[model samples]
Target: MKNESKELATLDYPGGKRRAKLRIVSDRVATATQGDCLRCARVAVRNLIIDGSRRTLGRVREASTSPGLVILGGNEGQAVRECAISDPCGFTAVHAREGAKLNYPESSPWGWSLANGVSIACHNSIVRDNVLTDCTDTGVVVYCSPGTKIEENHVTTKRRSAIGGILLVDAEPFSRDYSGIMVKGNVLDASGQAMRVGIGIGPSVLSDDMETIINDGSVIGNHLTGDYMGYGIATAGLQGWTIRDNLDDARYMGQPSDRCLDDPVNPPPQAFIYNSATLKESVVQDGFFDSDFAYRECVGLIVEVDVRVPGWWDAQHLENAHSS
Candidate 1:
C-alpha cells in the first residue's frame, strides 16, 4: 500500500470457497486516479499473493486510468483461484486522451481500458516473475480467463501507443471459455504488438454462437521481441489452440519476407494446432533480430497465415505457424 487514488489494493469479496486472503507483499503500489493500482474484484481472491510489488505511475501518466495489477472476476460465480503476481514491477502510460477531452464516457479511448501491465480477469491465475515496463495497453492481459498461467513474465514497451506483449483477449460480452490457458516462459518486448490470442466477437453475434467463444489456449516457450508492425503470434476464432516453442523477433515492417502466413480458409489439423501432440512443432522463426537494428532477418519458410478476429463478422480463418 503505497501512493494511491482510486485503488491501490482492493479485494471486494463476495463469492465462496472460504474467500479472503489478500497478501500484497513488499508493497509499493503507485498513483492511480480512475481506479486500479491493485484491484482484485468479486473476490474468492483466495490465497492471492501479489509478491514484491511496485505498481508504477497512473492517473495522468498517460491517463487511461487504472491497471497495474487488476484481477477481477466480476458477476461472481466464484473463481479467482490461487492468485499470484510474482516479482512485480508494472510501469507507466495510461492516458487515453485527457487534454482533448473525451476522457471517459466509453466510446473508445479504449473504453477506459481494463488497463495493463498485469490484468487477468481471474481463474486459476498465476502471472509469474513479473517485470512489465512502459505499458500503455497490454503487457500481460488474459481476460476471459480459465486455468490461466502466464509464466516467467518480463514484458516491455517503450511507450507510444503500446498495444501488445502477451495478450489473450475476450473484451467481454461474456461467453468466456478459454480453456487450459498457459502462455509459458514469457519475455515479450513491444512497440505495438507481440503475442496475441484472440476472440472479440461482436456483430449481432450468431454463428451458432461461435461455439460459445472457444479459445482452447496453450502458447508455449515465449520470447517474442518487438519494434511494432504487430503479429509475432496472432490467432483468431481459435478452436484447439496450441502454438509452440515461440521465439519471433517481431517482423512485418510491411512484409520483409513473411515469417508466417496462413489464412487460406481455416487450415490446420482441422483448425489450429502447431508443434507436437502430433501437430508437428513449428512456431515462427526467421533469423531473429532486434538488438537495435530495430528488427532484422526475416526471410521465410514457416508461412501459414490468416489472423483476423478482432471484432469478428464471419471472416473465420486462423492457423499461422512459424519456426527457425
Candidate 2:
C-alpha cells in the first residue's frame, strides 16, 4: 500500500530498479509517503506493467557523441535509446540478451564511473556506436559465448589517471573447444591493463596437470592505446590461445611520466603465456618476468648450470617443440 499523494514513478519491470525519475501527485487510490510509487491498479506482481515510457521525461538531450553514455536494455530484444543510465549497483549501463541492442546516443554526462558498463552475456547481442568513458572499472564485458558482435564501441577509463580499458574474459582453456567469438573495430584507451583473461592457474583438462591453464581464444583488429602498465594482451594457459591483429602504441601517445627511465616496460599481471604468437605478426611482446625482477634485486647471487646444448636438443630427439 503506497501513499497516493506521493510521487508516481514508472519503470520497466526488472530493468529500471533504480528509477531515474520521481513524481508526486494527489489521489487516494493509494496511500503512504512522498517518494514511493503509486500502486492504485490492484494488479498482481507479474501482471503489473510499469510504464517505462512515463519515466522518460526531463531527460536532457545529449549534446555530442564525444562522450556518449546511452545505458538502456534488459534481457529481452528491445530498444532502450538515449537512456541516461549510470551506476545501477553492479550492473552496467546497458545489458542485453540474445537479439537485443543498446543503441548509440549523443554523449551526456552521467557523472558516474562505468564501474561495469554495457555487459552483453547473451549470444547475438550488439553493443556499438557510443562513447563509453570514465568508467572506473571494466567496460563492455563479454563472457563465454558465441555469435556476439561487439564493434565500433569507444571504451576508456575516465579517471584521467585511470588504469586499463575494456576486459574480454573467457576462463575456458583451449580455444578449439568453443568455436566462434569475433571482436573487431573498437577503441579502448587508458588504464593499468587494457584486457585480461584466464585469471587463475591450474590445468584445464590438460594431458598433464603440471602444465598451466590456457584460455583458447582470438583477438583481432582492436585498437589499444597507452596502457603499457600491463601487457596489451595476456593469455596464460597451456595451449589453444591465438593473438593475431591487435595494436598498442606508446610512441604516438608518449610514455607515462611515473615510469622508470630504464626499460619502462611494466609488469603484466596475468598473461601466463601466448604460445600462438609469432615473429611474423606485427604484435610486440615486452615485459619483465618474476625471475628477472628477483635477480636484479639480489645483491649476492650464487648457483650456475651447464650451458652446453642438450644432446637431446637435436632433431633426433626434438618432440613437440618444432612446427616443421
Candidate 3:
C-alpha cells in the first residue's frame, strides 16, 4: 500500500519457482505507487486487481502509456485490468493480442515488419472477471498461449484499432499450430468509441499466408453491444473453431442492425470471416460445421477469402523443395 508519495510497500517472491510454480493465496494487499506495476513470467496470480490509472507522483503522463500489467510467459494464472490506455509503440500499433515485433521474411510481400500489442505470453492461464475501459490496444490478449480461458470480462474501448478486445493470437518467428483456448461470456462495449470487433481469434497481424493456425478453440456465449461494431466477432486463418451461441446486442444498443449506411459497399455481418478461400478451397460452404448462430442480429457468419495474398507456408515449402 502507498500513501500520497514515498515508497510505501513492496512484495517480492522469495525465489521458490521460476515461472509461477508456487501458488500464493492471500486476502492481504500490496501496492506499487509508481512505475511498472507488475511483470509476471511463469508465476500464478489469482484474485488480483490492476488499475492502470495509477501513476508515479511526479512522472510525465506518458508513463501511463506503458503496459499496466504484462505476463511474458507462464503456464497458469489469472489477469484482469481496470483500464489500459497505450499509444502506438514499436510493432504493437496494430494491437494483435500480445505486443510483439513480427519480422517478415524477405520474400514476403506484406511488409518488412509490423508491431502488435503488449505481450502476455502464457498458456492454460485464466483471464477472467476483469473490467477494462478505454483501451486503445487490445483489452485482454494472449500470445501463442493455448488452453487459456478468457471469460466473464467486461471491456470498453473508446478508441478503435485493427483489432480490439479479447484476442488470442500467435506471434513467433516461425509458424505454429495451437488449440483449446476458450473465449466465453465476455461483454464487449463499444458504445462510446465504436470498435471493429469484440473478440478476435486466430493469427496475429500476419495471417495472410497462414503462418499460424488456431484449431479446436471455442468462442461461445459472448455478447457484443456497441455502436457500428463491424463484426461482433472476427476470425481469420483459423480452422475447427467452435463458434456458438454468440450474439450481437443490437437491441440493447438501440440499433436495428450492425451495418452502417455511410459505407458504400455493404459491410460484412456481425460475425465476419476473412481469407476463407486461402484457408481451403471449400472450407467455407453454406454453413460451417463447427459454427451455429441463428440470429438476424448476428447474421449467422460471413466468410470472405482474398485470393491475392499468397499462402505463406505453402509458397515457402515450394521454394524450399525447388532449392533442395
Q: Which stretches of candidate 2 lie above 4 Å from their native place?
A: 1-76, 97-114, 160-164, 170-178, 191-217, 227-229, 238-242, 251-324
Q: What does candidate 3 score on TM?
A: 0.51
Error of 3 at 281 (Å): 12
Best by lDDT: 3
- RMSD (CA, angstroms), candidate 2: 19.1
lDDT of 1 by residue, 1-324 (tens): 212222322365323333333323323342222222233222232323333223222122333323333223222222222333322223322211111111111000111232354455555555565555434445555555666576766665433233455556463422546677787887766544322211111111111122233456677777766554343544434456666666655544333234322222211111111112211222323332211111111211232333243532111111101100
After superposition of all CA atoms, the RMSD between model 3 and the true structure is: 16.3
Candidate 2, 144-215: lDDT as tens digits: 434555566665543322223444433432232223445566666544322222111113111122233323
For model 1, where is the 10-residue window of minimal lDDT?
315-324
- Candidate 2 displacement at residue 161 in angstroms: 5.8
Q: Write the per-residue lDDT of candidate 3 for residues 1-324, one digit (tens) a residue.
A: 111111211134222122122111211211111221133222222212222211112111343243222222211122222222122212221121332211110000000021123334444555555455444445655565555566776766443222366666554422333466677898887655545557766563222324456556677888888664545565555667667777666322223245322322223444444445324322332323232222212222221323234432111000000000
| Deviating ranges (above 4 Å) for candidate 1 | 1-28, 31-118, 124-140, 147-215, 218-251, 254-324
TM-score between model 2 and native:
0.45
- Cα lDDT for residue 271, candidate 3: 45
